[model samples]
Target: MDRKLQRSWMMYDWANSAFATTIMAAVFPIFYNSVAANNLSEGTATSYYSFTQSVAVLIVATMAPVLGAIADYSGAKMKFLRFFAFMGMAGSVLLFTVNEGDYLLASILFILASVGFSGGNVFYDAFLPHVAKNEEMDRISTKAYAFGYIGGGILLAINLVMIMKYDWFGFPSSKEATQVAFVTVGIWWFIFSIPLFKNLKEKKVGDPTEKRDKSYIAIGFSRIGETFKTLKYYKQLLIFIIAFWMFSDGISTIIRMATFYGSTIGIGTNDLIAALLITQFVGIPCTLFFSKLAKWISAKKALTLALAVYVVIVILGYFMTSALHFYLLAVCVGTVQGGAQALSRSIFARMIPHNKHAEFFGFYGITSKFAAIIGPAVFGITAGLTGNSRLGILSLIVFFIIGIVLLQLVNIEKGEREAKALEDPREFVKVEVK
Candidate 1:
């Protein structure tokens, strides 16, 4: 791809991250608990939040792979991206209207936004091979993540300012001003996505001879079935997928529940926002640094290092009794969060057949969504049963340990070789035609 197109594609990271920052990381949950669920008891509010997020994951997990397969078959990646982006943005903007004592409405909007956010990522990951070469993918993926942290941090910082100085914004209260911040996230997501839509070319569909004989829906199910059966053939890729599933479960749970956990433990709203802001900016440089580290050490080893950091952070979080400790833990998490996730994407990209990028990335999406379900459900259950949120937080350590054990077993080089061999014949045929 040309430099302009590559940059345009990366900008989608900048565009969509505002949703993750304002809605997911900083504002929505806090506002929902304090205002939307003002009539509900504390336990009920927490349970509702957990249930809403889990439901979104369940819906996306079932649909994402099929959607991805269809997009690949029809060469409709950008079209699907636009559709889901609109859904997410509309859902985000709806949050602006959610006032106190509107718990049901708020929950529904959040579920819509969460679905949009998670679903959009499937197409976003599909664009990787189009924008960068094999050697450059790790760096490009990491840079996109770094940009995401910066973009998310910048928006969150502005929202924090609005919340802290509600009178300046002409809002009646901080809560009301926070509610308006959701609209900004929606607008930001829509406006930034324009460059990607304008500049990035959709992947060209293969000739009819290369196209699958079945209908897209039929091919989708068959591909999924084949993927499961073929799992035994791709030992290294399967092992790595399991490892990613394990660690990502822990990571997703932490992202979803951290703010709520802090609120429950007496951490002030300002403190929670500040801690997340710290993570956002801190993640930028660390993401870039990990890209460099991958050049020296393998991507898998670099991921292992990040997981080790996660173990330490989760362990420390378990012992956190004060706001200061929470702030410290947030910083630690920010340092590794973007880097680990970026490397994970690049590592998987290296292992998958290039022609089937979107199809395989669909499976990646499914695994991530499913993994999300387990950790949060476990966290919610443990928190409810024990009445100690710290214990729930601490349980994440098991995920990291198991993920690392599984990761160590994956043969990265072997998987890359296998993927290359599968694509080499097709590439040679293309060259002959040219």
Candidate 2:
């Protein structure tokens, strides 16, 4: 509940988002398509980028639960977070070395960076409940996303200027300017991370128990089985996770693929990056506004409203043909993208047993990451077969629709009630969270 602690925790979101904006969502996709994959056809390059994203998520999906289990017992969430953050930073810095026609290297580095980003997020998310009380979760989560947008937007704007006007930065060409931007993402991430590591402490993980006979890896695999057995006791929360997987996949795909998809259809790099910058700046206020909306209408209804807007965005993306269209679509997306995700995260945190935050969030991460795989793969394959990425955009409508349906079924009150009567999976003994 301390303001300083909350602000420190949120700063991680601000720091890491630079990489999200500059490397993942905006600049690199265009750079990859035009430079790294220069020799390949547009469709092939897009397909390759999509597949690499899938592979990275898959790898992280496999790792999430085990690390979560270990962190639960060891209270090593911060350690795991530090490791993945470093991995992401290294990947970002290494990206500066890529040269023309180095698509293979680019794919490998992207995969490495993506894994680090998603993997670190699992632990970062686990810290949410620890950082805020139940009542504070929604506000803090949305505020965190707002901070991300602002931090990421500032960096992207600077990078945009550098790439568009290389002479101002003393670069030999825009290519060199773009390469330095990649290094900046790494530097920005590391510098901003200092506050959280220095200021916050891991207060508790779960209730203390005797040391396990098994290794953390072995416990991780066993916990997955045990967690499923416990699912019957918290059905509403399980349903929410399923809904999150469906909708989150769609949300992630749009963020990951939008720039590349635009470039594939012939939008200029500066315009593509510019529109995304608009999304970032617009998202800052909209994310906070949705947090307020969650208070006014409840998190569930607010999230549902956001998902509804996404359906409109995807359909519009299908018909997008000009820079103005992309810019308009970006504005629409900024309005709801962070709101849906931030609300979903807070709602999940409230429903899960507080004693098992890391483990449940781990399961949450793995499922969502695996779900993330389907969207890009679907888009890539759909585009590859049809030879049109716009159709791929059209195809995402089903996910949001399915998610909205499932979300309606979640009874938040019931989930919170079940969480309060916590059951220790190790013994099936009921202990109230207090």
Candidate 3:
């Protein structure tokens, strides 16, 4: 079971999640609005930040499948993972240079850093099937989410204190502390990633005997084309991906837009932030609890239960009336968010052709990004038309509903059997290159 190897892979989650917390979620948006966009209105600053993030996401989502196909060809996952991780870390450190009236520079670095973070995760996810056996997938995946919660939560907690009590940290103001927080994310990410690079090795799946003459770039596209044509052989897996896309969109929309919705509706910023922090800490234990729950019941049932909870949460969100209500919703989200996502990853890992993890997880990444845009767009449109955020929040019910319906159609056992039947995994990448 290679406990050391599994832990090393999980540590990468702990490492990079600091970027998710301090840089992406908690500290940076506030810093960007106040310091980077010093002369701009708050609305304008937020708009610019959103635009920059969208740019980063577009680039990564476009590149993911090709990169994944190429990595699968020659045990290149580790190399690619290292390169993108460096990009993310470098961007985080460079954010320290941002000062008042430097929104352009801050935006550029944010785009680069986030691109790196998202790009690196494609390969990091590719390691899942290699690190753990079939029976261990749920435990390993759920625990990784738990590790992310604890690690990211700790750093964010420290950064919050640093900003709140800037004088105690010997900084001139909160801005200086915020800039330093960016550097801390970079250092923390790099230091924790060492264990992964040192301990885990990418298992080679490419065929040396079956040779091809095309450049990797061309071959990457070729591989994807072949994957598309042959996807019918993996029908259950395709159904699962569709289901995942729909539900994950709902989850991402809630995560990305919740604070803004809360702010728009008159909830205090401090209460919103504190409530979110509770989600992080509560997520740690609850995510781990799902691992045991999955073992007790089954991944599919556990995930179905989680999605059912999300439905209730959204309905409750429609009627939410106070800061206290928001806090309760945050707790509800914290309880199921990690479990649903963790189980999704593990379930996908179990279903795909073993040799094509990198290639397929790439698609997983892209679907997630694209689906992410839909919920927010729908929410925005609904809110705009109705002049109420409640209806906007309620609109998310459609995503979860469709996702659960499609999820029930996926035959996981048949999918696993189909995946196991593929022996010569390079049928398209090598011998059939014509």
**TM-scores of all predicted structures:** 0.93, 0.93, 0.96
TM-score, model 3 to reference: 0.96
> Model 1, range 37-112, lDDT digits (tens) per residue?
9999988997898788778888888888888877876788888888888899999999988988999999999999
* lDDT accuracy of residue 50 in candidate 1: 72
Could you give candidate 2's per-residue lDDT for residues 1-434 as a string of tens digits?
88888898898999999988888777887789899999999889977976777688789988888788778777888989999999999999999999999999999998888888888899899999988998889999999999999998999889989998999989999889999999999999999889988887886555566666888788777877777777777878989988998999899889877877887788887787778888989999999999899999899999999999999999989988898999999899999988988999999999987667787888889878877778887897899899989889888998999999999999988899888675456444444332
In model 1, which regions exceed 4 Å deviation? 209-215, 383-387, 423-434
On the 0 to 100 scale, the lDDT of residue 322 in model 2 is 92
Candidate 2: list runs displaced more than 4 Å: 39-44, 204-209, 264-266, 380-390, 426-434
> Total clashes, candidate 3?
0
- State the C-alpha lDDT per candidate: 0.85, 0.87, 0.90
Task: Please state the error at residue 81 of candidate 1 in Å.
Answer: 1.0
290 Cα displacement, candidate 2 (Å): 0.7
Listed per model in order, the count of residue pairs whose N, CA or C atoms clash below 3 Å is 0, 0, 0
Cα displacement (angstroms), candidate 2, residue 335, comes to 0.4
